[model samples]
Target: MTYLFNQPSAFAAELIEGFVAANADKVRQVRGGVVRSTRSKAGTVAIVVGGGSGHYPAFAGLVGQGLAHGAAMGNLFASPSAQQIYNVAVAANNGGGVLLGFGNYAGDVLHFGQACERLRADGIPCELLPVTDDISSASVSEIEKRRGVAGDLAVFKVASAAAEAGHNLAEVFRLAQHANQRTRSFGVAFSGCTLPGATHPLFEVEKGHMALGMGIHGEPGIKDTLVPRADVLAEIFVDNLLSELPAGVAAAKGQRVAAILNGLGSVKYEELFVVYRRVAQLLASAGVTVVEPEVGEFVTSFNMAGASLTLMWLDDTLETLWHAPANAPAYRKGSVIVAEALSPAEREEPVQETLPEASAVSQQSAQRVLLLLEAMAQQIQSSAEELGRIDAVAGDGDHGIGMERGVLGAVAKAREVAARGAGAGTLLCRAADAWADQAGGTSGALWGVALTAIGTALGDQQEPDASRVATGVRHAREGIMHFGKAQPGDKTMVDVLVPFSDHLSQAVAQGASLSDAWQQAATVAHDAAQATAQLLPKMGRARPLAEKSLGTPDAGAISLALIVNTVGSLLHDKTPV
Candidate 1:
């Protein structure tokens, strides 16, 4: 699909242009995208840097009061050259020297190395600091080659403090290097991303899968798998990150870190915390001290569906810099915590109201069906985080967690239903009821209605068939609309589900197996979800945000299409291995 979002060519220029225009009082652009402050003190070690674009506040966005002295801007996913780096360093070097810090990439090293040598020739003291924090993207043997992700901020902050304290360029450079050596990070992506002028995505996984350790420039990652829950993925990302650090090498060591949970883009704050809850616990268990954990978009790849965890072993100096007074457009060190309060007894962060246990079931056929359903439920349960990332595009972005909770609830209900010798329809309906009751959101209500309608249509007597399955979905759509009051044009999941069920019913009535009919249904749903981007959404929370959502398919509709597609795929293929 064509991206409605800003093209890097157009986007980068606009962003840098606006930043310079508004921050005029705080900074002055030197030759190349390198900007300098007119007020920077003479003989004060200067912090000069740049990287690929889209990670504002890292190389450019933070070039203001009490922060960096100069920033060399680059194009999207493209680093600035030696010329650009030289321009910034020459301007920023006022005898106290200049410390250059940037993400580690081959191009950056080549260019920054050239710039450093050039500055040295000019009698300007210069040292280079490259960030290597995303352990997810590299092997220990190849850590030096791994591209820096969100660790830019932590490492840079250390250098900035040294510079502000009037340390010679050498000392400042050493501190920045120290931060880079100790910091580590990891990321997970629900979907791939694209550059401004690109057509196809830079990387792609199955609709329901995630790419673990996906890098900044839409780089492919080490692992790809279905991820349905934010918390589960959070646990995985956190564990991987913790395992890489020296502090996590042993418990009771109590290593301290200032952590960052960064939203690449489009992933909202409301949804990000679900991941953070698990991450915090993982770090605590590893005996890593989290001095202050930040949760927001500090580094982004233009609405890419992912989050990265950055951990820095906070030495006393780094801790002071982290807590140092600072202000920038997207970040402020004094940023207030938006987290809700928790009493001692009220244990869970979100108070994860655990679902009831599955009931025992007897009938062999019923049990087999449940076994298959359980697989689908397990798949959903395992995919919560990725779902949230995809859903953030259009709907409320809670579909991942909501869908996961609903599936688990359905699993529990399925066991109880099967135990009572309930018909296929009856079991499905009971599961639907539990899903709706436990999962509090739109997806829950829609799936719940679908299951309930299917059960009623069956009336406790008939075996499920292609035609009846389609009929049940149709009835479910009707029920969903009645309660949700959402129309097909409203850019909701109904947009995809209604047409999907209709095609299923028509195809089945025309003679098709359950598998074939479902496959067709999923296909139509996929197309429909994509088509919702073209329609005007007139209802839901999306209506207000609809303008920004143009050209982006509804995440809820995408989820429906994905879940249905997976179910059909499961029915057609060998059972889950």
Candidate 2:
């Protein structure tokens, strides 16, 4: 369990703060995460790798010379927001473009992909390298669906080495792709890890038993079996990875591989060495050569009693890149010539947005929007624990906390903009940006999209009518679907959002009042959310544990329903048109 934390919600932020302070010479703090304090060579592709916060050394620790240019850290087990990724990329960008690398999880894909598009739109060349190395997550036929695990280290190292060698963006991306293709990892957990301030761990394994193929984000393993001897466990890891050799590697024999025996969190180095001893014997017996094999924690889940093994089959180019010099906070390969530190002037600052002019009617509407945001914040704060419980059934169990952080940030931003006499549209847009920035996850990005869509539909110059509001809601639905790629039956928030938007639009078109229409739609949303309990998840982290989520409604769907119902009640009370 996490013993040192002031507040659970503030843990991720505080940890980043302390990490930057400790490694000030190596890395500097940025808006989202950390960037190399030293300047990079001109025209080198910036390698930005990231994921959730608990995996120390993986994200922030890897930001230094000859490694990642920066890392966009997220909430406990959540993906960083698009705004966060964009900010880091902008800070890290040199003359060359950016290469964003992360685990191939649903949230990471959604957030990082959005950031890539935004960077491209801004005329920055950007590419994505999602590491898919965990063989347990998906079958070989569906290799693209596999989740990234400790194997992220191999991909990050190779890509960053290529970038440091002054390779252009395209070449860096190609090398990273090659690294990802050659990597494979498998893990087992004796026990689960607890989040800060949580009374219980995310999941548990029975005593004397170990969970096979567990994830770094506190996800339970796919299967359970009695704990085996260290040599036997080593055999299991070697056997699984050898069973599926990457394309181009016709056989494990005569193949040179970079082997990493990673301790998830609490597993000691002594224990890992014992396992690696046998691991070495197995590889040697199989005629596979081990090169620079790492035997310690590289990517960890906060204090999880688990370990994983990764084997990256190395060709000539990969082997040379794998042996390249690297200097980071936690990872150091060899001697590197220290570069000059970035000057204070080179560091970027937050740009304050200028408020647009607003009419009196629109300004008054902003006040009503502020009230709605406040109510949503309160509702989320009250229901966060329950929402997290539901999500923990199959997901990472951070939904409630994520929503609380998002809604609170939105309310705060709305209040700030409304006090400046901003219009409803401007206020909502500002709030949307804040929600995405503060929350930093899939739901955060989706909610930000939804709010921005509504705000765009209702321009700042005019007061919104019932039809205009319905149109805005419909646009929100469309935007979420476009960005999230989840259909109604995917067991996501779309299940509730689509029905609510359809019903509200239909009612408004039939000349119903805004309040009445919203009330009716809220009922439909509530029913839709409840129906999610019977549907299996086809997206997100829950997909791997679909059966476990059979009796629980999606946390995203539930939160959307609750927020819309809260808004419906406010509308019914005649708070505003």
Candidate 3:
């Protein structure tokens, strides 16, 4: 169980602060995450790697001389926001372009892809490389869908080495993809990890059983079986990896591979050595030679009692890059020249945003929007645990907490802006920023996009009428579908959002008032959310275990329905004809 935290919500930030304080020799705190305390050569490709923050020694811990230039760390067990990714990438970018790398998770994909687009729009070249190396997450035919596990280390190492060797952005990205393709990881957990301040673990296992292929986020594994002896466990790991050698590798015999026997949090080094001993014997018996066999924690899942084995099958270039000298806070390879640490940079002053002019009617409408947001925050807070339970059935169980945090943040910002007589558009824009910044996950990004898109459609200068509001909702739906690449049947929030938007637009066209139209649309959304229980998830993390989510609605879909319904109730009392 994890302890030692002030507020559960503030844990990731505090951990980053302490990490920077302890490793000042190697890392410095940046807006989104950490960058190298030591300056880098000009025109060198920057390798920016990150994921959720629970995996220490992975993101920030790997930011130094020859590894990642910076890491955009996210909230615990959640992906970073696009703003965070963009900020870190901007801070780390040199004359050469930036290469973004992280695990092949849905939230990471959405945020990083958005950041890449933003960077490119601003004339900074950016590329993304998602590590899909865990074989257990998906089958051989859909290998690209696998979740990245400990194999992330191998991919990040090779890409960073390529960058250090003066490779261009394209070459760095290519090498990173090569490393990811050549790597495979398999893991087993005796138990699940407990988040800080949480009373129970995310999942559980019987005393004499083990979970096979469990994710690092405490997501239940694909299979469960009786616990085996250390040697037998080693056999399981080796046989699975050996059965599916990388496509280019002819056979395991006489092949060189970089092996990482990683302990996931609670497992000890001594135990890892025991497991690796058998692993080595098995590999050697197959005429395979292991190079630079690492036996320790690389990527971890809080205090989950589990271990994983990674095999990075090496070719000439990969082997050379794998052995390159590197230095970071937690990981170090061959001796690296000591680069003098620079003093921390002064914080930049915040630029004041000019408030857009607004009409009196829109300003009045903004007050109603604020009240709706407050109600949303209250309802989300009340139902968070239930939403989390629903999400845990098929995905990482953080939806409820994430929604509560985001809605509360949005409500707070909306209240403050409304007090200043801001218009509906301005209030919603500020609230959207707050929600995305505080939430820092897939839900955050999608909600941020939806709100921002609506704000854009409804100019502050005009009164928010039923026609305008319906238009804004349609715009929001389009933006979400384009950004998230999820359709109505994908079992995402889009499932409800599409129906709600269509119903609202149709009702408004038929001369319905805003309040009445919203109430009807809310009914459509509610039904759509409920209908999701019969569909299988085809997107995001839940896609791997679609069956497990059979009878439960998607957390995002359900939350959207709840918010719409809550807002509908408020509309009757507040919206003017």
Candidate 4:
């Protein structure tokens, strides 16, 4: 359990500050994360890796020469915001393009994908290669759906090595993808990890029993059984991983592999070495050669009592990359030639966005937006716990907290900007930035994009007519779909958004009043959210535990319905045109 913390929310930031101070020779503090203090060769493809902060060496620890150029560190067990990812990548980028790599998780996918889009729009070349190495999350046929775990090391190392070797962006991306395809990992936990300031773990294991197929996020394991002896546990780990070999590998015999016996957090090195003892014997018996075996904490959950074994099937290229010299703060390989330290530069002031002038009529509508934001915030606060419970059925149970954080931030920013006489578009754009920054998750990014799209449609210079409002809704729906990659039947907020936008557009085109159109759209969204209970989730973190969510509405969809209905109440009471 994590016992050391001043404020739970501030833990990640504080930790990063300390880490940078302790490793000033190797890394420098950036706005979003840490970047290499040592200079890189000009025009080298920068490899940026990141994820939630709880996993130590998996992310920030790997930032240095011949490893990751930078890392976008997020709050405990939560993915970083898109702005954070973009900032880190910007700081790390030399003249060459950037290759972003991380675990295959929902929040990471959304944020990294958004950063890639923004980077490309700004003419900075970027690509993403999400590592999918945990075999238990999905079947072999559905490997892309699997979650990444300890095997992150294998993929990141290969990609960083390729980049350091002067490989182009395309070649580095290909090597990262190939490494991910050839890696497989399996794990078990004696107990779950406790997040900072939390009294209990995310999930519990029965006493005297062990949970199998555990992840690095403190998520409960897929299966549970009696705790085995050290040798027996090693046997279980090896068997599960060997059950599914990488494609083109006919058998374990005569195959060379890189083996990592990793402690989750609380598991000590002595315990891991005991397990590895049996692991080595079994591998030798199977005629599989283990090369450069690593036995210690590499990737870890916060005080989680568990361990995992990763096997990366190696070819000649992989072997060369795997053995390449690295000089990170935490992990070091063969000796590396140090480059000159980065030149000291004065910090630049952040550029402020200029707000366009607004018409008096649009300014009045902006006040109405402030009211809407207040109502939405109140509704989210009241429903947060229920939303979390629903999400916990098949996902990490943070949706309620995340939504409440985002809505409250949006309301606060809207209130501040409205007080400054900002127009609807300006207020919403500021609020969008605040929401995404505070929430820091998949939902946060999608919500921020949706709100920004709506704000764009409602220009500051004109009055917001019914047609324009409908257009804004349609724009928001499209933005969410494009950024989140979620369709209506995926049982996400998109299910509610699609119907709501369609109904609003149809009603407004049929000459309905703004209030009337909104009422009809809210009804459609509410119904769509309820219908999600009957549909299986086909995306996001819930996809792995799809069956468990059979009778529960998606937390995101339900929250969308709640906010829309709350807004409907305010619209009903307003003066009708």
Clashing pairs in model 1, backbone N/Cα/C closer than 3 A: 8-196, 227-383, 228-382, 228-383, 228-384, 229-383, 229-384, 229-385, 230-384, 230-385
Worst 10 residues of 3 by lDDT: 344-353
The best candidate in terms of lDDT: 2
- The superposed Cα distance between candidate 1 and the true structure at residue 53, in angstroms, equals 1.6
Model 4 stretches with alpha carbons more than 4 Å out:
218-222, 346-367, 415-422, 544-547, 573-577
lDDT of each: 0.70, 0.91, 0.88, 0.87
Mind sharing the TM-score for model 4?
0.94
Question: For model 1, where is the 10-residue window of minimal lDDT?
Answer: 347-356
Q: Write the per-residue lDDT of candidate 1 for residues 335-439, one digit (tens) a residue.
A: 532223223333212332233233232133345557766876776766677767655654445567667767787889889867666656567767875665445
Off by over 4 Å in 1: 1-10, 247-253, 334-577
Give the Å error, residue 198, model 4: 1.4
The C-alpha RMSD of each candidate to the native structure, in angstroms, is: 25.0, 1.8, 2.3, 2.4
| Cα misplacement distance, residue 254 of candidate 4 (Å) | 2.5
- Using all chains and alpha carbons, the TM-scores for the candidates as numbered come to 0.56, 0.96, 0.94, 0.94
Q: Per-residue lDDT tens digits of candidate 3, residues 54-99?
A: 8888788889998999999988877887878888898888779999
Displacement of the residue 78 alpha carbon in candidate 1, Å:
0.9
Query: What lDDT score is found at residue 266 in candidate 3?
Result: 91
lDDT of 4 by residue, 322-407 (tens): 99999998788888998788767622324654667887877788998889888889999999999999999999899999999889
Flag regions of model 2 displaced more than 4 Å.
none
